[model samples]
Target: MLPTVILPGYLESADVYLPLQQALTALGTPTTTVPLRKRDWLPTLGGRSMIPILRQLDRTVSAALVDNQAAQINLIGHSAGGWISRIYLGDIPYTIHGDVTEAEQLWNAKAKVANLITLGTPHISGERWTKKNLDFVNDNYPGAKHPEVRYVCVAGKSIYGEKKLGQWLAYSSYQQTCGEGNTWGDGITAIKAAHLTGAINIEIEGVKHSPRTPGIWYGSPAVLPQWTGYLS
Candidate 1:
């Protein structure tokens, strides 16, 4: 079995994915997480650039490859980390920061990744603050661009975005993600925005975006079985 690496979402730390790592390992897949701390995300607060996070992701992938003695591994990215993984998979130069040095590039990670699983990731976004990075990802590496890697996009259908107070947060998040608010989502990303055209798209009924959210989340033990089958 290929080893698995988990990349936490924006502002999330490796600790937050401990449950998920343990769950995957328990399922007979050796799993590890990119050692990211909340403070590490501070450098990219304004969505300036994800180069820093990409650096860490590359290091972790390299280490996982060595530790497992495997040629490739499965990559599971959550939220912003998903799109960032798309960038890592592509050979297109990441020029969001004005001509990335060759040394700073991820050296095309797709070659070492057998599967790319995304959890409630907003593949499309309308928010101005996130335009730069999202634009770079969508424009360069569109839905399931790589043929060698299996892309599995998982969406949650726990919340229906509405104008009402109870669902306003999901409404706003959906609007920012896909330019529509009155749709179903995982309290953070709309189902439409989380799926990729050429990927194996899946939707789980009651799963939220993050572990901190009430009820089960993408990384929850119950939800793990829903998407883990794709890794095989």
Candidate 2:
């Protein structure tokens, strides 16, 4: 069973998380998507403002889901979604410089991260790297206070490039931003990258995207069995 929550990436709709949410729920686990409001700071800071945003998000999600008792929760995120997930699961106490108890800190993971699953995210000292981002996904975050939760990264197999009408215009910009090889859901992020960052990665291949596809497709049940072990 899963006691997890899903978070979406930038310019994404809550719809992106619906499939996985339903899948977990079908497995008889509670799941929900954390709704994010449009913020003025998002464009300027990107997800680098993740610490504060997660603190605020923790308040809303914990309130709505746990009634103040959200102890063990799996956090599944993609892209910028994964960035926020790392900040939420991490234990540095909101980078805002506060003295809050670890248990009382944002996302309140004094217990431990039940699971941290990321999809198509860059978790190491990559091209546009920053120390803050480096610490969690990069340094594996000290003060975990528990066994670092199981980490599963599902990356794309095929690289998306500016070859045709579809891939070039849409995906080229995203890859260029990170100095990453052009990719969609099929590009494999090096496992060495995960080792350097201290997270277990589950590499999946051949499920490319077209920017036309939204979140999980209704047909993904066929692929679900393949990833079930990773989910476990």
Candidate 3:
């Protein structure tokens, strides 16, 4: 059986992905969501600790795929999970200020995989929170291409706020959120951003950061239709 790997963001876990996973399972897809151990502040400090975050995802994705004998891995991410997918395929480097000597980008380009589904992910040059992540995607992945790895992005339109996905105050000076008229655009960009980057884009209508039909983090039913299209 093929593998459909769904990843949860910071505090998000099997519970958050349960609804989405069950929905996919109905389609005859063997779905699995790997819940990273709950971290109190790692996500809130993504900027300073992004390297560690990316590393954990890399190891997890790699091991899960191999152990399950998954012939192909279909990737799906929400918020921080979306950011993780971007890091995995696009070799864009995010310099943790001057902290590390060598700049680290998301994903080991060599990791074999198929398809990337990004939900409510921010990847534009100038969104409310692009400075930290965009630094790499913009600089390194401009004309970049990942063979055998197709990508689909689905952004939200609701009024919501999330730690890894939002631009807000944090325990450390690293995290950014969608606070104070930050308007709708959280740290991640919406639909237009992905299209501009040349991805196989699937724009979902009637969804927002949060407070809309689907409830931001866990994801909204309005956006699930888009996910079904991609995850399938």
Best by lDDT: 1
Best by TM-score: 1
Cα lDDT tens digits for candidate 2, 65-143: 4642645666666555665666666555554433345565675353445677666554553444344554554355532
- In Å, residue 29's CA in model 1 sits off its true spot by 1.0
Q: Please report, as a residue range, the 10-residue window in candidate 2 with the lowest summed lDDT.
A: 187-196
Provide backbone clash counts, one per model.
0, 8, 21
What's the alpha carbon RMSD for model 1? 1.0
RMSD of each: 1.0, 4.9, 6.4
My TM-score estimates for the predictions, one after another, are 0.97, 0.68, 0.67
- Residue-by-residue lDDT tens digits, candidate 1, 1-232: 7999999999999998898899899898899999999999998887687888988999999999999999999999999889989989999878667646876667488999999999999999999978998998888888999999999999999999999978999999999999999999999999999999999999999999998887899988877778999775
lDDT of 3 by residue, 1-232 (tens): 3567776654554565677787677776667776565663355353444555556666666675777776567777665666556666664444545543444444554245677777665554333444566556555664225656767766644332334543342211122332223334322343444342566766554464322223443254445655666553
- For candidate 3, report its TM-score: 0.67
Q: Give the winner by TM-score: 1 or 3.
A: 1
For candidate 1, the per-residue lDDT at 23 reads 87
Model 1 TM-score is 0.97
Per lDDT, what order, best first? 1, 3, 2
The lDDT of each candidate is 0.91, 0.52, 0.54
